[model samples]
Each structure stands twice: as C-alpha cells, then as structure tokens.
Target: MKTYQVGGSVRDELLGVEPHDKDWVVVGSSPEEMIEAGFRPIGKDFPVFLHPDTKEEYALARTERKSGKGYHGFKFYYDPSVTLEDDLLRRDLTINAIAKDSQGKLIDPFNGQDDLLNKKLRNVSNAFCEDPLRAIRLGRFLSYKHISDFSITPQLKAIVKKILDSGELNYLSSDRVFAEIDKAMQNHFPEKFFNFVVENKLDKPWLKDINSLDGFSASNSDLRWVELSCLNHFTDFDQIPLPSKIKKLISIAKQLANIEIDNILIENIDSLRILRNEEDIMRILSLGLECMDQNLITKIVLLYKDIKFAELEKLDPNERKNEKINLLKDLVSKL
Candidate 1:
C-alpha cells in the first residue's frame, strides 16, 4: 500500500501557506488491512482510519457515485483498483484535487497546480454538482480567500446555481448549514460569506429575514455577529441555534435599538432587570451600546454598577423591584 498526502494540506503547501491538518489517501488498502496495520477505524460513512502514532486521518482511496438526493446521497466505492488519480477526480475543486507522494513529488492529474497559481477555483468534473454541500463549502472558501485574487470558475458558478435551483439545500440540517457559515464568520472578511449566499441565490426561509436587514456596519466582532442574530423575531430567535448568552444579548440589543433615545428616560426601563453582575451586564450592554451614544451607554452602565443590589435584598421582594425601577429612573433622569 502507498500513502499520499492529499487535499488541502498539499494545496496550501503549494501556495506557501502552512497546512493546519494533514489528510492522507491510502491506495491499495482495505478497512481490514488498515486495522491490521495498526490504524484505528474512525469514519462512520467511509473507510477512514487514524494513524496509531500521529492520530491523523488516512482515508482509503475511493470514488463516489450519486445514488440519491442531497449531500449524503453518494455511494462510495473503494478497492485495490481505485488509483490515486481516480480518488482525486472525485474531489469537488481542482485546486484541492492534487496530492503529494512520500518524496514530496506533486501529483497534478487535473492541473490543480495551474489553477492554484492562476487563483481560480474550478471543479474537477461534473461530479462536483452531485453534492449540495460543496456550494456552501465554496462560499466559505471565498470568504477565507477574500483578500486573494481567486474567483470561482463560470462552470462552478453554473453548477452552484443548478444546486440552488434544485432545492437540495433544504434537505440539510440547521447544524450542517450553519457549520460552514460559522467558519466563514471566523474569517477576516466575514461579510463576504453573507454576500456569496445572497448573490448565489442560496435561498432558505430564514434568509429572507436576514437579507432584509441593513447590511453589516458594526466594527466590533461580537457585535457584528450579534446584528446577524437579531434579525429574527423572538418567536424564531431560538431557531438560529446560537448560544443562549448570544441569544439574550441579541434579544436585549434588538429591544434597545427599537427604543427611542428621547423616550428612554420617561418610559419604563424596568424590562432590563437590575443587572448587578459586571460580566453579564457588560456583555449585554456592550451589544446594546452599539446603536446608542457612547456617553449615554457609559452613564447607564456606570449607574448599573453603582446601584448595589445586595443592599436591596433587605427590602421586601415587591418593594425591591419598585426600588430598582425607581433607581433606574432616577439615574436616567440625571443622564
């Protein structure tokens, strides 16, 4: 059996970028053979094993044929006859289809090296359109390489359009869909991710609410993600799968943004409970302060810090609530 370093590790190395992880393609190997050779099986859907020493993944060379619908519809074929070139051809993008041997010799059966140098994201074959997840993955790659001169090939664009039009994306779960989106958000220019999804017409029901919002202008990274989360109403807020803390912050920020600045002093600010804990208050206040004046936010936050809720514990529970509201009103009046 021969092991060749494959996929992004090889592609990134060629572009002078440090690879984060190394994936190997083992030719002329079976699941039983890999296990006997000391590799531990890990893959649930395909023949993948982890190196006993290094713990890196090494997948048996395989080819896939579309058998049904969505991303999971493919049936994998792996055998001794499946060469490295056959396995490479099954890859989604040309730039990711290259492999490297033990001696560090590059394998470019599909001219992946050429595409990398030209900064082009091209598909290896028509089999690219078979998997719907590739479109989302490509969108994420676009965000990651936003600074680079790379652009998707027209062929791939048409394939993405076909996938989007087919409504295969609806079959994907919220976790799977957002995994790619969250990865893109971690990039330097995350806005490009939303742009790609919108521009490509990768439409889903929830996207309408998000697309309707004013484009991202927030400079703070957390606040930027907060703005994206706030687009949904309270009823649908939990559907987005955000952390509970983020949900609370987004809910609070949405309410804060809607409140008229002039009327905040006169109207009831009782909805905002006596937030005494500095960390919790700061987390919510930071997002809320995005739309309001910095001076006003500072005053409000300082007022929250100054009001000692521990002192209020001596009073009746009902009276304590009133006292908290009274203290907030008094502080707002001063501001």
Candidate 2:
C-alpha cells in the first residue's frame, strides 16, 4: 500500500504555516487489507481508517460520483485500483488537492503549487460545482490569515454564482450551514466570511439574515454570536440546534441588548454573577451598553468579580441572593 500525506496539511505546509492536524490518503489499499494491518475503520460514507498507534485519520484513495443532491447524495467508490489522481480530481480547490509522498516528495497533479504561488483560489476540476457547500467553504478560507489574502479567480467566482443559482445551497442541512459559520468564526478575519456571503448574495435559505458585520471585532465565537444575533443578523440562532447552555447565553445577550441602560436594576447585574462565565456575560452587557463611558465597563467587570465575596454557603438561598442584591446596590452606586 502507498500512503501519502494529503489535503489541508500539505496546503498549509506549502504556505509555510505549521498544520495542527494531518490526514492521510492511502492508495492501493482495500478495507479488508487495512483491517488486517490493524487500521480501524471510521468513515460511514467512505473508506477512512485510523492508524493503530498515532490515531490519525487515513482515508483510502476514493472517487465520488454525483448521484442526487446535498452532501450525502454522492456515491463513493473505493478499491485497490483507485489512483491518487482520481482522488485529487474530486477535490474542491487546487491548493487542497496537492499531496505529499512518504519520502518527502511533493506531488502536483493539477499545478496546485503554481496557483499557490500566484495567491489564487481555483477549482481542481469541474467536479467542484457538484457540491454546493464549496461556495461557503471558499468564504471560510477567505477569512483565514494565509488563504485570506489569496484572490478567488473570476472563473471560480462564476462557478460559485452558478452553484448559487442552481439552488443546491438550499439542500444543505441547517447543521452543516452553521458548521461552516462556526468554523469561520475562529478565523483571523471572520468578518470576511460574512462579508463574502453578503457580497455574493449567497445568504439564501440558511444565512438570509447575514447582512453586514461592519463594526464587529471580537475573535471569541460566543461574543461573535452575541454581537451578531443581538443585531438580528443570526436570526437562525434559535433553530441551529446549539447546546442548551449556548441558548441561555443567547437569551441573556438578547436581554442585555434591549435593556434600558439608565433603568438597569441591581437585580439584573446581580443575576449575571450566577451565570457560568461571569466575565463574558458582563462583557456582553458592557457591549449592550455601548453609550456608557469606558470607565464604567472596566468598573463593571471589577465590581461583578467581588459580588460573591462573602461566604453565603451557610445562609438560606433567598438570603444569599438578597445579600448579593444588597452588595450589587453598593457596587452600582459607585458606578
């Protein structure tokens, strides 16, 4: 069997960035043989295995043919005869299609290195138009540090526009749509993800509420979510099947966003100290009260830190809360 390092790790190495994760593509290997060699099967829709020792993913060289619609409608074919070139041809971008041999030699099947040098994002083959999610993924790579500066060729943009017009994006599941957005939120310039979608008018069905992210500057995903949803952009927030804790955070952020800063009560501030993350919750409240002076935000974080100073473990729950309420009164008076 011939195993080669492929996909994002290769692309990141070409760009001089150290990759955090690595995936392998095995050519001339079958599932039975892989099992005999101690590789654990993991893929549900494709032939992917995990190395016995390292536990890294190692997928057999496979080719996919479009049969219907959406991400799972493709029919994946894998066998010992599937060439490395066949697997690369089915990839989305040329940069991602390159592979590295076990002997430290690079394989450039579609001239991905040339496009890498030109700082261009181009499709590997015509199969790129087969999966509509690539359009959103393009926006994802556009938000990162290295690929963020790379130019999307007009040819690829036209393909994306074609995919958008084909209505295939509507077939994407809500979870998949949010998955892309969630990953983009971790990028260096995540606004580029939303900006690209807005510019391309690719916000139909799932991302319809994404209009603009003009003044957003936070790199924290929860902060990003609060900022975006508070402005009514991530309107699909309630339907995204996120964790219950995240839902509570969104609910709290919404409360903070619409609350009258002048009429803000001590109870509201006191309630914040009970949440899991006092710092982020207070930060969200501070963002909501943008008209307040910068001194107030700093003081608010500091004051909330001390609201639970006394050992209320011995008192009744109601008295403990009242104690917090009284302390909050003293704290807000200083503000």
Candidate 3:
C-alpha cells in the first residue's frame, strides 16, 4: 500500500506554517487491509482509518457522485483503481489539492503549488458546484487566514450565487453553520469573516439584522465581541456557562458600552479580553469573591456600581419598594 501525505499538511508546508494535523491519502489499500495493518475504521460514508501509532487520519483514494441534494448527499466510490491524481481532482481549492509522497517529494498535478506561492485560492474543478458547503468553507478560509489580498474568482462566485439563489442553504443546519463560524472566530480575523459572508450574500437570509449594525468593520476583536454578544442572546449561556476568558471579554465590552470608552483604550486594552466575558472570569476564579483584582476588574465593578446608583436615583418615591431606595443610598454612602 502506498501512503502519501495530502490535504492541509502539504498546503501549510508550502506556506511555511507547521501543520496542526497531518492527513494522508492511501492508494492500493482496502478497509480489510487497513484493519489488518492495525488502523481503525472511522468513516461511515467513506473508508477512513486512524493510524495505530501516529493517531493521524489516513483516507483511501476514492471518487464521489452527487446522489441527492445538500452537502452530505453524495455517493462515494472506493475502488483500488482510483489514483491519487483522481482524488486530488475532486478537492475544492487548488491550494488544498496538492500532495506529498512518502519520501517528502512535492506533487503538483493541478498547479496547486503555483496558487500557494501566489497566495491565491482557486477551485480545483467544476465539481465545486456540486457541494454548497464549499462557499462557506471558502469564506472561512478567507476569514481564518485574514488574507484580504485574494478574492474569490468570478466562476466560483457565480456558483456560490447559484447555490444561494437555490434556497438550499435553508436546508443546511444552523448547528453546522454556527460550528464553522465558531471555528473561524478562533482565528484573529472575525471582521473579515463577516465581510466575507456579506460579500457572498450569505448574510442576507441566514444572518439578518447583523449587517445593519454600525462599526461592524472596526476591528476583528470588536466584530467578534459583537457577534458573540448577539449569539449569546440566542443561546442559554447560563446553562452552558461560558468560559472565564469569554466572560471577562463580554464584561469588558459591556463596560466599554456603558462608559463610552475612548477608541484608543478600546483598541489597546489587551487581545486576551477580546471574544471573552464575565462567565469566563467566574470559571477561572472557581470561588466566590467580592472582587477579582484592582486592575480592570475593579474598574468594571466601580463603573457598574455607578450605573446602578444612577438608575436607583431615577426611581420615584412611589416606585420604590419599601426601603429599597434607602438601602441603596446606604450602600452608596459606604462606597
């Protein structure tokens, strides 16, 4: 059986970034042979195995046919006759279509290396239109890498527009869409991500009202905070308990909004606070305390107290419940 390095590993190597995970495409290998070789079968639709030692993925060279609609509606053919070149031809992007042999030799059957060197992202074949998810993935690649130099080719954009016009995106699950968005947010370029969605026309139907917001293009961090806050409104954060970092981030954002913080401080506070909230802080502390620290947390608390006091003053005597106003006055006096 011939084992060849393929997919992101080869692409990242060319771009000088150490690949986070290595995937291989194996030719002349069947499921039974892989099982005999101590690899575990993990794919249901296609024959994929996990290496016994390295624990990396090794997928057999295969071809596919569109059997139905949506992304998962495909029939995979895994005959030994299929070659590595045939498998690469089925990929979405030219950069991801390149592969490497067992001896670390580069393989460029589709000029994927040229696209990588030029920092361009082009589709491998017309089969790209068969799958609707490619558009989302393309937008994600743009966002994740923060690569503004490259634009999606007209042919690809036409295909994406066709998919969007078909209204099949409604058939796609929100969990899948949000999962990709969440993964893309892990990168440092969320603003670019939103811009990609808008440019591709995906934001109009799936993500309405979001495009109407002002200052959405301020920075990646600002865009991320706003997006996370909006998403939190839909989800039950109390049940899931967002991490301390995310919680601190949300709290810091709220503080910014309440106090109308300067643009300079907002831009330079710290990267760690972006895309985080108060629940993130509580998780890190792990114990109930009056306050966390005197740095930013203290400032946040004092600002929050001041806001609460102002609101208390706005309440008329008739609206006050018993001695609640008196109690608030006493608390403010102590502060």
Highest-lDDT candidate: 2
Q: lDDT rank, highest first?
A: 2, 1, 3
List model 3 lDDT by residue over 1-335, tens digit each.
89899987788788777888999999988899999999999998899999999999999999999888777889999867889998999999888988899788888888988777677778888888788777777777876562545667778778888888877676665666766666666665665666777767876445553442222322344235444454434222332234565555555444443322222232223322422443443332232222233234434434334433335556687665434445434433443
Instruction: Quote each prediction's TM-score.
Output: 0.88, 0.84, 0.71
Write one digit per residue (lDDT tens) for candidate 2, span 146-226. 888899999999999999888898888878878888888877888889889988888776665576766564667767776
In terms of TM-score, how similar is model 2 to the real structure?
0.84
lDDT (0-100) at residue 234 of candidate 3?
28
Stretches of candidate 2 above 4 Å error? Answer: 214-216, 231-236, 265-277, 285-335
Worst 10 residues of 3 by lDDT: 285-294
Minimum summed lDDT over a 10-residue window in model 2 is located at: 288-297
Error of 2 at 208 (Å): 2.9
Q: Rate the local accuracy (lDDT) of all candidates.
A: 0.75, 0.80, 0.65
Candidate 3's clash total is 15
